[model samples]
Target: MVDAAITPPSDVDTLAAGGEHCSAHEATGHHGYAGDAQALQNRLRRIEGQVRGIQRLIDEDTYCIDVLTQVSAVKSALDRVAMLLLEDHLSHCVVGAAEAAATSGDATEVNEKVREAAVAIERLVKS
Candidate 1:
């Protein structure tokens, strides 16, 4: 049985999932939401439906290839959302941290921020 709950990763969720709540924002500057949150939500909602549809295909005993097609679509949709969030984070959090480190002459803060970004990218790549 497919578990039906689908939660999109928000800024808080993503940050915490990676580690801390993006405390390095001070290095980059006061980072905040950098994209259209509403649009992201809408896209996630659609992806959630796609997930459900794949489940339905399985329940209906649909052809294997057809179900796989839906699975592929769902994966692609989720990847898009992840990319959007990643782009937003880079623009806001990462950039802000870099600026903050520069302004404060605290190179370690920049290192920390880069490490965080690297971890995030690693997670994305692994998945």
Candidate 2:
């Protein structure tokens, strides 16, 4: 259960110095998963249920191996979600940046986008 005293950050709270940003949605205000936001939410809801199930298993004194197996399932589900987001980011943000750069005769945005993707990929791999 979440602590009532602990407030989660709002979108404005999470903003950097520049401005507020929605996850997977940058300056253009386009979410990479805009077309499938509901689907994504559903997947996340399922994951949440899985987590609750894990908690119940522990409460019931489930076998160590069984608990670990559920934990692994959760991890894999999360990884799949991450991969989907990454794919959408590549298809939307990176491609959009490249297209815009081509017209503006500037590679800065494209380079930045690529670098961001590389960093995200690295982090995912490390995890």
Find the candidate with the highest TM-score and give its number: 2
Question: Compared with the true structure, what per-residue lDDT tens digits does model 1 show for residues 29-95?
Answer: 4444534678888998999898888888889999999999888888898888888877777776666
> lDDT of all the models against the reference?
0.66, 0.71
> What residue pairs clash in candidate 2, if any at all?
none
Q: Could you tell me which 10 consecutive residues in candidate 1 have the lowest summed lDDT?
A: 1-10
> How many backbone clashes are present in model 2?
0
Candidate 2's residue-wise lDDT over 56-88, tens digit each? 999999999999999999999999999998898
TM-score of each: 0.74, 0.78
Candidate closest to the true structure, highest lDDT: 2
RMSD (Cα, Å) of candidate 1? 11.4
What local lDDT score does residue 1 receive in model 2, on the 0 to 100 scale? 21
> lDDT of candidate 1 vs native?
0.66
